[model samples]
Target: MRHYFNDLPKTALTAGYWLFVAYLLLPLTLMMSMSFKDANFIAFPIQDWTLRWYAEVLQDRQFLDAIAYSAFIAFATTVCATVIGVWIALVVATEGIFGRAAIFALACLPAVVPGLINAISMRIFIRVIDLPTGTAAIILAHTVHAVPFVVIMALTRLRSMPKNLTDAARDLGADPFIAFVRVTIPYLMPALLGGMIFCVLTSIDDFVRTFFLGGYKPTLPMLIFAKVQGGMSPQINAMATIVLIATALIGLYAEYLTRRARK
Candidate 1:
């Protein structure tokens, strides 16, 4: 099977890989193009462009507040998610924790479940606990969404390590903390950074959970959603273009980092 997979021509291989890349990029490109239309109607025939949506969205204090709030929540939740995810990965990969499979299954619940379902369930749960329905709820919901991804990212790093390297560190009079600091941490660096960036992206880009959890203040995605629903605007196109650029840059950087790690 390995030989058969490896036997494909390099051009065929490259094309297949780019096929996936194109699939990921196409919608973003379309969204960006649509956002820049000079007219109110979002037609696709390549007309004049304007930055009014960007100006208007930026001018609104509510939208500005949403961006700030989303940044804060995403940063905090990313930290929390990374810590928990890496810890869980370490324990499961090295410590043989009880019912590891079951634990991982539970952790993955948020990812597998529908976003609306997760948001509804979370809203009810938070209400039961008497939690506020605004930024606090958004942060908590984002954390829940981010944890499983962080775990998966960290696990890739953990499994990629050669067992012998860690064992040798331990044998050299280094305890768990010391060995991890000196050896595992450095090797898993790319995965950790990538995971955190991915978590931030997921948190900021999420609309469904944020819509239910956020009150009054809207995140950038929610703001985009609201403007999009009412009617198309040139400035909205401009904002969407900015987001598409940001996403592409992050994904490209992440891909580069992963490739560098392999090399």
Candidate 2:
């Protein structure tokens, strides 16, 4: 009877875990299913499935352009965010730095700020600085939004790192810069790579900030949003499914790389 009671909790947890997985995956499954629908419009009963939507989406010039543009912005944002984040993490990790806690908090604040608010504030800030709304502005906004995540990841890795690694390098007649480049950077690679992946994902998915700062050229999210305004269709679903699959692949690849780095 006691074993049955103990097993009851385990069974419940197992059930709950599957249920949570279903909750997360069911919607995505439905969305993917819809992309294969034969009809132009979105509907259930997907009795007639076709690859026409996917075929058309692949041939779309606008879609291709948006994908390329978003990829560019994501790359730029990742580079900027990664550099700034690593710098901030180093500063916070250093001893005898003034207001280290405050600096860390401020660096991470943009992450917690509401997206709409951040977008609006960034719009105002750009205008105040006379920075025209375009690719530069969009990259700037994404960099700001992405920096905090990089900081947190890099900082966590930094804190867990042993001091002896760098000390050993220093004792071997290596200067601070050399030690940092050789020892510190290699140790921080997994974290930096993970952060860069996250930055890419977030920047690509960002719509609000991009919408506000975008000029004539449209990003992938912006293009998706514009299509959604027209109405939902299997084509749109196909586009979304393509993006979802691409991002998922990127995330999985990052996980593989991080695990490999640890080993």
Candidate 3:
């Protein structure tokens, strides 16, 4: 016998969802409020609401520098990761590649493995290889981490792609490169764009891996972590709020563009 629809729980589900949403967003909401507080101590229910902290972040040299550094690294990671990931995906999609499964597993190991362990291992490996721990090193590390995500996204699109499209293009006198550029790329653009955005954000917000790999340069997240450890400040809260808002905006824009492309 089927249970009656009236027997189903409703309020419990709503309560649980609300609790989960609060868990995900309460800290962010608190941070947003703290950013506007006019005092050093981070008290809930801000006494004064001011944009002073936001202005301070704008004027602070260290904050500006960190933002620039993070931006550079994120952009670099997105580009390198996208290029390598797409190329690897193309190789994976092609027939008769030796040890294709092995290659896929190797490429995605960074994504599935514990990042802290990976960081330590990467640090050891880089030192052995005589690679300097600087921006270049961070870029390399970020790219390696970013590539797996890129591959997963690109491969999903590539596998479902029809072979007849490429064949038809070839029959119409288009070269392999042209066919891929004109057809495959346009079709794969959404997943590729989404992956690139994810890569950039990951590289930007990353502190643990960047902490171990970075020589001296403090990326924005690293600096924020340091400030957070010292004490709570309106400035830190303000900066965090700004970053969170920026990330949200980017995600929304990317989603809009990708959805539009699909339509």
Best by lDDT: 2
Across 197-261, the per-residue lDDT of candidate 3 in tens digits comes to 99989999888789889978799999998898987788998998999999999999999988997
Model 2 agreement with the true structure over 113-206: per-residue lDDT tens digits: 9999999999999999999999999999999999999999999999999999999999999999999999999999999999999999999999
Task: List the candidates ranked by lDDT, beginning with the highest.
Answer: 2, 3, 1
Looking at model 1, residue 210 earns an lDDT score of 91
Query: What alpha-carbon RMSD in Å does predicted model 3 have with respect to the real structure?
Result: 2.6
lDDT of 2 at 178: 100
Instruction: TM-score for candidate 3, please give it.
Output: 0.95
RMSD of 2: 1.7
Q: Give each model's whole-structure lDDT.
A: 0.84, 0.95, 0.90
RMSD of each: 5.2, 1.7, 2.6
User: In order, how many clashes per candidate?
Assistant: 5, 0, 0
The ten-residue window of minimal lDDT in model 3 covers 1-10
Score residue 162 of candidate 1 by CA lDDT.
96
